[model samples]
Target: MEQSGGPRGPEGNEEARAAAHCYRHPDREANITCTRCERPICPECMISASVGFQCPECVKGGSGTGHAADANQPRTLAGGSLAADPRLVTKVLLGLNVAVFVAVMIQGDRLLDELLLFGQAATEPYGPVEGVAEGQWYRLLTSMFLHQEIWHILMNMLGLWFLGPPLEAALGRARFTGLYLLSGLAGSALTYLVAAPQQASLGASGAIFGLFGATAVLMRRMRYDMRPILVLLAINLLFTFTWSNISWEAHVGGLVAGAALAYALVHAPREKRTLVQYGAFGAMLLVVVVLCVVRTAQLTG
Candidate 1:
């Protein structure tokens, strides 16, 4: 082809001549060609022989690198970061939990009591008062993020930081977040159901414990030996049972919920993914509902 400025051959114009000059020195003049528009691009613009000379337009259209990543393709943890920064997300979650814990503590016992009870204890004549009653059933979800003590929040967040990343990396952020929240709700519901009707509880331990439980199950699915996980679970269970006022119900419930959620959410194909995820989520919700109903009955009866 020809252009107004000059012929469009390899060495037709000043730009082409310069490109040829560079290419000749490198003994690569034969491979320079515009990939986009096929304008016989100069060596300066030409990428290489393997991919051909991608024209400016083509490069722009290609967007940054060479091509867009497939949306469905799962991304592996890159740059050794998968392991090095494994706890990065967990750290952020930890910070949030700690901050909330402090805020609850500084607000004093009156506010702390109401905060711990959330909205469920609103009508109760004793125990912690519920702060935001009515339409705040959402607190069951939010309560997982609020802890009353430094050690309580720290322990939970640390557990999450240690345990959450591997699962998150395996499952993707969206699924991992969903499991955490849902598991926390399940944990809280179980606590409320099994404990004194007026007892108040608060902590991220339920969600963190859920992550541990889920990881244990996923590890098993991945063909890893379950000895270490079993040991850890046993230790946590022992602690729960031995510790006074630890809300063992929440711990065990969250653990089971997390395991179920992990089983449903991880390593599934697109077609069956929805079925598994929704099924697990629905089942967990059903358990929570049953617990709530049973608790309500016990209180009324």
Candidate 2:
């Protein structure tokens, strides 16, 4: 006869312990099993459910019965998939900015001239012209990664380090990357639209401001305390208007674009989330292109 709740033999205990480990991460011990699949899952692999926690696969597949096979998969708060390393995109962006800064330091002003945002200008006194107006539109993007002053790069990189990880995790790599690039382009387009044709500007401030805007939106959406980000944004905006060297146009443009994009990404209906999120991205890109084109026409025609 067998006794219930009695001590087991060594082989039996070892098998029991092995069964307690998470199916997805064998090394992790799990006290809870997925409500849908009944498989052991660690906290990281658990997705909160109506009754209890479910595993990623169950959430991706549909309901506890797993009936809707073709339904959209589960995603992050902003319709993005969770990543193994959430900070990968942030690290890459930081690395690119740093690498461009180092290259500028080594190559001197020549590289800076090629990379910085300028609407229209002659390369040399009385020489042939070159700039965004002359079809050097790449400057809008390259300029976001270019910085000359040590203080400029330091400030921007510090902002990136602080604001980047959370947004990357929330938005995932692809959407976060799209937001950054589009925000930067929006900034460049605005600057080109309003600033003097011959004015030169270069820095990551535009993209950084965009991150600031998106962060505020994300915090509000998650119902997190918004005071801290709001205070920081206020301080930055104050500096933007007060500091003579700062490009206020870029800051403002990025902030608006980021806030709009983030809102669309996080608040879209679950049934149509992907379409709305990506559609917003395409719309933002279209706006940027239109701005650039109108500015180019103003300068060239």
Clashing pairs in 1: 35-53, 36-55
Model 1 — which ten-residue stretch has the worst lDDT?
A: 72-81
TM-score of each: 0.65, 0.79
Report the poorest 10 consecutive residues by lDDT, candidate 2. 1-10
Tens digit of per-residue lDDT, candidate 1, span 63-107 = 323333311121321101112243456666777777777776677
Model 2 regions lying over 4 Å from their true place: 1-74
- In TM-score terms, candidate 1 sits at 0.65
Pick by lDDT: which candidate is best?
Answer: 2
Per-residue lDDT tens digits of candidate 2, residues 103-171?
A: 998999889889989899987899888899999989999999999899999999999999898788678
Look at candidate 2 and tell me the lDDT of residue 145. 96
